[model samples]
Target: MKSVTVKNLIDLFKLEVLIGNEHIGRVITRSRAHRPGLEFVGYFDFFPMERVQVLGKKEINYLHKLTEEERNHHIGNIVKYHPPCFVVAANQEGLKYLMKYCEQEGIPLLRTAEPTTEFINKLDMYLIQALAPEMAIHGVCVNVSGIGILLRGKSGIGKSETAHTLIHRGHRLVADDVVTLKKLGPNTLLGTHNESTREFLALRSIGLVNVVRLYGRKAFQEQSRIVLDIELTHWKDQALNNDLELEPKFSDYLDVRIPYIEIQLQPGRDVASLIEAAANNWYLKQQGYSAAEEFMKRLQNE
Candidate 1:
C-alpha cells in the first residue's frame, strides 16, 4: 500500500502533539490533505477519511462561533469518520474543544506554526516524493555536459570502467552497478545511486574504488535526470543492415520515452570520448540543431 505513518509527518514537520500520542502510528495513504470546513456543517456524505484533516484559521474561527453543545456535536461527528489525523495550522486558538474530542476519540492532533497554505504546500511535496514510483536498473549513470547518460550492458562489458574513465575526464558519476529510477512527473525520470553503492565504483582488475575520493567531490552527483540511454554491445554484434545515420531511438522507463543509442565496444575505440561526443550531440539536438541533417542538406546542394 506504500503508506507512511502520522509519526513520519510529525517528525518531518516538527509538529507539536496536542493529544493522542499513542495513535501516531496511524497510516496515511493519501498524499493530499483535506480541509474539514464542509464536514463541520453536518455535511459528511463526501468527506475523505483517508486524508489528514486540516483545521486552519477559517475553520477554527467558524468553530469559535458555535455554541458549546453544537460544537461538540459537530466535532464528535467529524471524529467519528476516523481520519488519519487532524493538523491545526498557524497554531490557531479555539482548538480546546477539538483537541478534547480528538483525545477522547484517540485521534492524533498535531499543531504547526506555519500558515495553512504554506504548510500544505510543503506537506504535499514531501508526500509526493515519498510515494513516487521507483525501480532499479542494472547500469551506470553519469552526467556529461549537463546531460544524464545511462550506460547499460552485460556484466564485465566495462560499464563501470567506462564510467571510471568518464569521471577522470571531469564528468560526474551518478550511479554504478545499480541505478534507482523514480518517476516524479509525467515525463520526468530521476536517476540516483543505490544507497549501498553510492560514490563507489567497481572495476574488473582494481576491485572497489571510491570515485569521489579519487576524483574529488565534483566527480559524483547524488542524482540526475536521465535524458539518454546507451547500450554497450560487443563489436561482433554490430549489424551491417542497420542504418549508420543518426536516427532517434527511444527507451521506455516508467512510460517516459528517453532517447536511446547503442555503441559497439571494441579494442582501441575511445568509448569515453565517444560518450562525451554523444552528450554534446544530444545537447545540440535539443537546441534544434542536427549535424547529420545539416550534412545531408549540404550533400544535396552539392
Candidate 2:
C-alpha cells in the first residue's frame, strides 16, 4: 500500500494548503474538529500512520456552530490524540479556522473546491489498496499486448529461461524474479518488480545477466495490469485447491484476491509452450468459451 502523507493528499485532489503543517497520522480525517471515524463517508481506521487525513462538508458545518473555546478544545483534543496531517473539506465556505488551527499547531490543512462527494470518492479509492506481500521467488511477468501474465516456479525451473524465450517470441516482459503486486481496485491488479530485480534474469549455468542490456529495453516493463497468474512447481505430493476450478481464486493478502494458476513441472515439459497455451486458454475462458466445460457438457448430453 502507498503511504499517504499530507502532501500526497494535497497532490491527489490538487487542493490548496490551508493550515496544520506539522501533523501526521495514519487515518485520513474527513472532519478536523470531529473525532476520527465519525465521518459518515470515507472514514477508515487501522490504517498506517502515513495515511492521509481528510475532512468533508458535513463535519465543517458541524464545526461552525461550536464556540471558539469549544472548537479549540475539539481541535486541541484531536491534535493531542490523533494529530492528523490534513483537515480536508469541500471548499472554504465556513472553514477559515482550519488554517488558523494548522498554523498554531503546525498541522497541515488542505482544502479542495471539489464537492465533498467527489473528494471522498477519490480519496477512498486512492487509500484502499493491497500491497504485494514480501516473498523470495524466481519468476517473470509479462504484459503481452496488455495481458498481465506472471510466471512462477522453483529455482532452475526454467522460469527466467522461458521468459526469455517468450520475449524472443515477441512478448513484452514486465518483471523478473520478484513480482510486486498491488490491488488497485476490485478485480484490478497491478504488478511491478523491484528496481533491483528489473531485467535481471537468472540462467541455470550462466548466473544473472542484464536482460535490458541484451534485449534492448523491450525486455522490461515497470508496471502492468495483472490479468493472469501461473505458478510452476515440481511434481510433488501436494493438492491443488479445487476452488480455482470455480471462481478464479488466489491467496488473499491484505484484503485482495489475485487470480492464480499452478502448473506442476517435470522433465521434458516445455515450459515456454505451456505458458503460451495457458495464455491462450485463459483468453478463451475469459471470453466465455471453456473447452473443459464444453467436454463435460457433451459427456452429460451423451
The TM-score measured for candidate 2 stands at 0.61
Local accuracy of candidate 1 as per-residue lDDT tens digits, 1-302: 67899999999999999999999999988877899988888888898899988888999988899999999988999998889999999988767788888988889999999999999999887887677788999999999978999999999999999998899988999999999998878888889987899999999988999988898999999989999999999987536344447557999998989999889888999999999999998888789997768888999999
Off by over 4 Å in 1: 35-48, 58-62, 65-78, 237-245, 296-302
lDDT of 2 by residue, 1-302 (tens): 22445666666568776654444333443322232444323334543333345566556766777788767766655554345565466565666666676677677777777776666666665555322233333467887655788787776677877888887777777777787776565666677777787777777788888777887887677788777778878786556454424456675533556577777777787777777877887788779998768878898999
Clashes (candidate 1): 0
- Which prediction has the highest lDDT against the true structure? 1
RMSD of each: 3.1, 6.6
Superposed Cα deviation of residue 243, candidate 2 (Å): 18
Worst 10 residues of 2 by lDDT: 31-40
* Model 1 TM-score relative to the real fold: 0.83
Q: What TM-score, computed on C-alpha atoms, does each candidate reach?
A: 0.83, 0.61
**What is the Cα-based lDDT of residue 112 in candidate 2?**
76
- Tell me model 1's lDDT, rounded to 2 decimals: 0.90
